[model samples]
Target: MTTYIPSLTIPSVVLQHSAASVLLPIALGTAVGFGTRPSKTQKTYLALKQPPLRPPPWVFGPVWTVLYGVMGYASHRIATIGLRSSASPAIVETAQNSLTLYTVQLGLNLAWMPLFFVAKRPSEASIDIVTLIGMNAYLAYLWSSIDEVAAWCQVPYLGWLGFATYLCVGAGYLNGWDLHDKEVKEE
Candidate 1:
């Protein structure tokens, strides 16, 4: 795996502390959630022809909040514990690479709402989520060799992403791959 990508990787200094690392994703996720306009997103969500087993719209907020925190802590663990555990250059490089992938996956995670709700593009949203799942799965695998706790922390996130992928694709299929028609206007 590549150790670093200037664009995709967050600088190590910003995430050096445990609290900063843990709060980073949570804060970003919250901003994205609000920035996309939740009322509009919720309206759009309800307007769609949803697939079976879809959770109520309210469920997403808490679930994502928790997932973001967990994933953030996982990244912290990978960066600190993983790095301190080994003096080897390869291990240090892997930790950096894992953090890079974490940032990339986070971008993908933040993109889903805008794609699905704001842009009203279910097909693109589904594709984005599928890609997110694949990237995070690989990320978790990388984390395993560095920090066991960090690797384990990703299990819930990976599980949730699997279910979310199903929801995205299923919603797309149910709605004929077009969320544009389902767009709801606010008063």
Candidate 2:
């Protein structure tokens, strides 16, 4: 006997759930990450020797704004599917794990800016970014099993994470800062 899996079909209710379920976290993370950038942090970022393909600082805000919005929708899609398929324990379990992974990645995303820009420690930021990339990959893989569109939505986010990793590694290497040093000198 062969078992067949059904593809998820988007329902009209997704429109209702997308805004609150998706946008809220994306907006909150974006606000906290960008809001924490003070003049000192800006200066620190400017002083760093960026990687070869690093885009101008201005590009990040806009790029993240768009990416976050799309990410929210994609997440909402998965959530809606899970809710509709609540009768199936296996599907519910997968959905729960999927959302948990998304939340973990977002938390890491929120933490990166403060650690890198505000704290002026690219070493820690590098570690966070690396973890973020891994989480993103895992999320994408898990999401693909349930929803191909949702999985594809993470493409740009994944690409940006790669670029961010390059930037973080470059900054950490060039600065030669000691991760164990607890002292943060004011500029």
**Largest lDDT belongs to which candidate?**
1
TM-score per candidate: 0.92, 0.81
For all candidates in order, the CA lDDT equals 0.85, 0.74
Model 1 whole-model lDDT (C-alpha atoms) = 0.85
Candidate 2's displacement at residue 127, Å, is 0.8
Mind giving the per-residue lDDT tens digits that candidate 2 earns over 26-141? 67766886588555555566666666876776787778888888788878877877646443777766866777677768778888888877677778889999999898899988
Q: Give the poorly placed runs of model 2, Cα more than 4 Å off.
A: 1-16, 178-187
- Model 1, 68-149: lDDT tens digits are 9999888888777656755478888788778888998999999998888888888898889989988988998998998888
